[model samples]
Target: MINFSLFVATVLIWGTTWIAIAWQIGPIGIVLSVFYRFALAFVVFIIGLAALGRLSLPSQWRFVVLQALCLFSFNFLCFYKATSLMPSGLVSVIFSLATIFNAINARLIFGERVQSRTVLAGIIGALGLVLLFWHDVTVSLDLDVVQGIGWAALGTMFFSLGNMMSRKNTAHGVTPVIANAWGMGIGALVLLGVASLSGADFILPNTQSYILALLYLSVIGSVVGFSTYLIMVARLGSDKAAYATVLFPIVALALSTIYEGYEWYGTSFAGLGLTILGNLVMFSRIKPA
Candidate 1:
């Protein structure tokens, strides 16, 4: 039941985050918006942890810092930049590949056994994504689109690394909430430093809607979402937990259809079906030899 809840939470929250990110794009640059969003989330999370008397610093601060930089700072920056270049639906489809990446990385780093089902699922999922977005890919000749695909792929790789690092920390008995709070704090500082050096504006928006959106992202998306996801990873293993990314894109596509009037061709549905089937295959536990 905990696993089911975590899966639902991750899919629902992350699926909606793409839309929230889209909302943030008009007035501020992507870097600045990402910086502010994370910074605010960090502050809020720390304060809440402190108030609850649950905050504890990591023993291996340097490792934690590296994880933060990779997971929170660079990963998010790449995601936003990718969205800037490609359609949100396409970016979500690209992110669905994270499950495959996590499986391979887990096998290599943690000596976890890889199932043939996982490889097969990953291949099917990739084919689904290609089929679903072939029209969008064909219509664009812009260099930005190519660059976006590259950035999204890199972002997914970073996310896989972060997952492995989190699993390592979990093995050492570090709580997910504590690790995430510190990680977010470190990531926020790094992003803020970059914004400062680049002379990016740090001014807060006056609009109530923008303020509300920021708050929602900080509290629900970052703090709750990260904590729940890490906990899930610790309990269920990285390969299984990463199934959330594969499934969440379908939620994003659904939301896009409702809110953004996103048009779905036959290929999009085919892609969605294939992606889900692949994830089911990838996450299925095989019998022991």
Candidate 2:
């Protein structure tokens, strides 16, 4: 039940994070916003861990660092860049491919079994994504947008690697909270260094709304979302927990309908049906060995 709740929380929070990202567009640059989001979240996490006496470094420092880089730094950078160049909905559709990437990579790297049902579900979900965002995809594709899709794909790949790494660390008995806090800290430092190198301005938004958005993103989106997700992965296993990705875009699309005033087209509804069906097939608890 706790695992189920974690999965639901992860999907709901991350689904709405796209809206939050949209709010971050004006005033702050993307890189700077990414840096601030993670850095602030890291600080808050560290303080919380200290208060709870739960903070500890991983035994395999190098692997932890690599996980941080892949999960936090590179993945986010690519995702942000992808959104910058393309529509959020389109970017999200591409991001849905993470399940496919994860399945393949897990099979190759971790000797995880690749079930036929999982593969079929992944394909159905991909098709659903396409249908859901068909309108957005039908729009003229600029060079930048094309490049953005590529980056988004790369980000998904990095994310899959991070998932595998997290599973590995969990097998070694490291608590997800401890691993996440340290990984986020390292990722924050790396992003900060990049910001410094790029001479990115780090001005705080004076508006109450902007400040509130930043706080929500840092605390709720980054820290809470990430920690809960890692915990879910630890409890549910990577494949099961990763179903959140399938559910997230659906939430995002729902939010879009309300906030962005997006109309629900027929294709969109069909896509939603297919996506849910695919997830059901993939996570049906049937072993595919």
Candidate 3:
């Protein structure tokens, strides 16, 4: 039940982040914006944990630093770039590939076995994603589209590596919440350094929308979403935790219908059906590795 709750919460929160991320794309450098988001998340999350008497440090700094880099910083840099070049929802489709990445990375990094069921689920989910975004898939395949897909794929790989790091941190007695809080702090510093070295301007955003997006990204998306997600990674294993991302499109469909005026097609409904089937396969008694 706890895992279920975390899955739902992570999906719902991240589902809405697409719009917030879109709102964040103007004027500010992607690195600077990511820095601000994590900086704020770090301050708020650390203070809350401290006030609750729950803040704690890990046994070592190396894995936490790696988590900060892969999960919080470089991943978002690639994702934000992808969103700048294409629809944010399309990025979710690519992000769904994280399931496969996590499985492969686990096998390579931890000497874990790769289950056939995991591979089947990923194949089904990938087909679904291709159907769901078929319009974009069948488009001209221009440079921007290629770049967007590449960045999103690269980001997903980084995120999968981060999941492995999170699992390693958990093995070292670091709870997900503590790992997330510290990761956000270190991630913010990393982003700030990159932004500074790139000569990105530090101008404040004047729009109300940008402020609201920043708040949503910092509080709900970074703090609550990542905390729950990493907990799932710890408890369910990174393969299962990564599979939760396949549900993101369902939430995206609902939100996009209301806001983005996304029209549903026959293929999209079919895609959603396949996606749900993939989820069922993943969570069923299939003896996952």
Candidate 4:
């Protein structure tokens, strides 16, 4: 039941965050917006943990630094940059490959065996993603689209690295909440330094929509979503937990259709069906042990 809840929460929160990111595109600097989101999240976690008397730092800072860099900071920097350069759905489709990346990384990093079912499910999900983004992929090669794919792929790989770090932290007996609190703090500081060095504007957005988006990204997306997802990673293993990415693009595309007027065709429905079926296959417990 806890795993189920985490899966649902992570999917719903992350899926909608794509739209919030879209809202965040104008005026404010991308790095600044990323900094603000994590800074706010860090503040919230610190206050919450202190209030609960659970504010101790990790015993080892190495994994925490890794977690901060990959998960809280760089991955999001890539993702927000990817979002600016590509359609949210296309970026999401590329991000969904984290499932495959996680499988490979888990095998290499932790000596975990990659199951055949997981590989098969990844193939199906990749096919579904291809169909879902068939229009974009088949279009005449634009430089921006190509660059967007590159950024998204990089971001997904960084995200997968963060997942491995999270799993390692958990194995070393760190709770997700405390780990995230420290990670967010370190990440926010890193972004602040980057923004300062780059001379990026630190000005907040003037619009209500952007402010609300930042708050939502900080509180719900970073705090709730990351904690739940890391919990799932600890519980289900990174290979299975990372399948949540497969579903994120589906929901993100659905939201895009409504907000961005993305036209859905027959192939879109077929892709959605295949993606869900792929998720089931990934999660199916009836396979041979």
Choose the strongest candidate by TM-score: 1
Give one digit per residue, the lDDT tens place, for model 2 in 26-97.
Answer: 777777878788888889999999999887877776667777888878898888787667556555656666
Local error of candidate 3 at residue 6 (angstroms): 2.2
lDDT of 2 at 183: 86
Q: How high is the lDDT of residue 228 in model 3?
A: 89
Ranked by TM-score, the better of candidates 1 and 4 is: 1
Off by over 4 Å in 3: 140-142, 261-265, 287-289
For model 1, how does the per-residue alpha-carbon lDDT over 18-110 read when each residue is reduced to its tens digit?
767666666777777777888888899889988999877887776577679878889988988887776666677777778888888889998
Predictions ranked by TM-score, top down?
1, 4, 3, 2
Q: What 10-residue stretch in candidate 2 is worst by lDDT?
A: 133-142
User: Please, what's the RMSD in Å of model 3?
Assistant: 2.1
| Candidate 3, 17-130: lDDT as tens digits | 987887899768899999999999999998999999998887788899999999999999999999888767767767877877888899999998878877787788778867
Output the better candidate (1/3) by TM-score.
Answer: 1
Model 1 weakest lDDT span, ten residues long: 280-289
- Cα deviation at 194, candidate 3, in Å, is 0.7
The Cα local distance difference test for each model comes to: 0.80, 0.78, 0.84, 0.84
lDDT for position 60 in model 2 = 70
**Of 1 and 2, which scores higher on TM-score?**
1
Query: Which ranges in model 2 have alpha carbons more than 4 Å from their true place?
Result: 86-90, 139-148, 285-289
Question: What lDDT is reached at residue 86 by model 1?
Answer: 63
Task: Give lDDT for model 2.
Answer: 0.78
